[model samples]
Target: EAGVVQSPRYKIIEKKQPVAFWCNPISGHNTLYWYRQNLGQGPELLIRYENEEAVDDSQLPKDRFSAERLKGVDSTLKIQPAELGDSAVYLCASSFGRGRSNNEQFFGPGTRLTVL
Candidate 1:
């Protein structure tokens, strides 16, 4: 099966500008996730999806960030009025199951969004 895929791989925008990123999870995977990676840091969960349901999203920055998994398949994450501090890699990951023993997720290369 194909692995997760992301677009642009990189982006640059000014503060207060709008930016959007796209993601496609692995085939047959029922769980998808979006994570934020700050420089020199591990990925932090932003949101998670179990098919069409958002099973976890407590860490999303509601003030300027938003995300959705349309049709429970492909997902998109957007940041309206981006801030300079938002500059980081936005990673998309997917997993075969949500069970504790099957929790390892496959990750995309990520979209490096830089708000200048």
Candidate 2:
């Protein structure tokens, strides 16, 4: 019944540096997603995983961003050579199923990254 958990609620780094965020989803959830929310905007899906497989990642920035859910439980998102525009809240969510009808995602307190 616990919600997803994310680490390092806030981070600040210089541009061109590297940073990483971590997430641990609910115990029974099988699907995980990473999202990014800019100021005054809704969360945008960056990548999605069903178990250890990455099922949807079209929106992810392959050049600088990467994600992985190794054991289908906890996940990590990383951004290398971070840019100033990369400052945003990175959210982690999970759901019990992949089907839209039964998928009710639980979100974690996002990690707010500030690229200076």
Candidate 3:
């Protein structure tokens, strides 16, 4: 079937503006994840969802970043009052099962956000 889908492939906004991203995972996948990747660095997990429940989100900056997965299918991530330091690639990935050791995650093209 299809891989993950994300919208607004690219976005440019001034500092303090609000930005949101959308994601649709492959059918039959039970796990979803959101990650932020900085230039020259690997992706960092922002949140992980097992079904509609958020199982891991310790790394998410609750002050400005928030995410949700409804009915265990699609998800959305939002950043309010964006900061220059928040500019990065936001990725959405999905897999068949929970945890990272057993399954392979399929990633979307990602939404590149730029804050000026």
- Which residue pairs in model 2 clash with each other? none
Q: Rate the local accuracy (lDDT) of all candidates.
A: 0.91, 0.94, 0.94
lDDT of 1 by residue, 28-73 (tens): 8889999999999999999999998888889999898989887989
Model 3 residue 75 CA deviation (Å) reads 0.3
Query: lDDT tens string, model 3, 1-116?
Result: 78899998999999999999999998999999999999889999999999999999999999999999878899999999899999999999999988663699999999999999
Per-candidate TM-scores read 0.94, 0.96, 0.96
- Cα TM-score of candidate 2: 0.96
Q: Candidate 3: lDDT over CA atoms?
A: 0.94
Residue pairs with colliding backbones in model 3 are: none
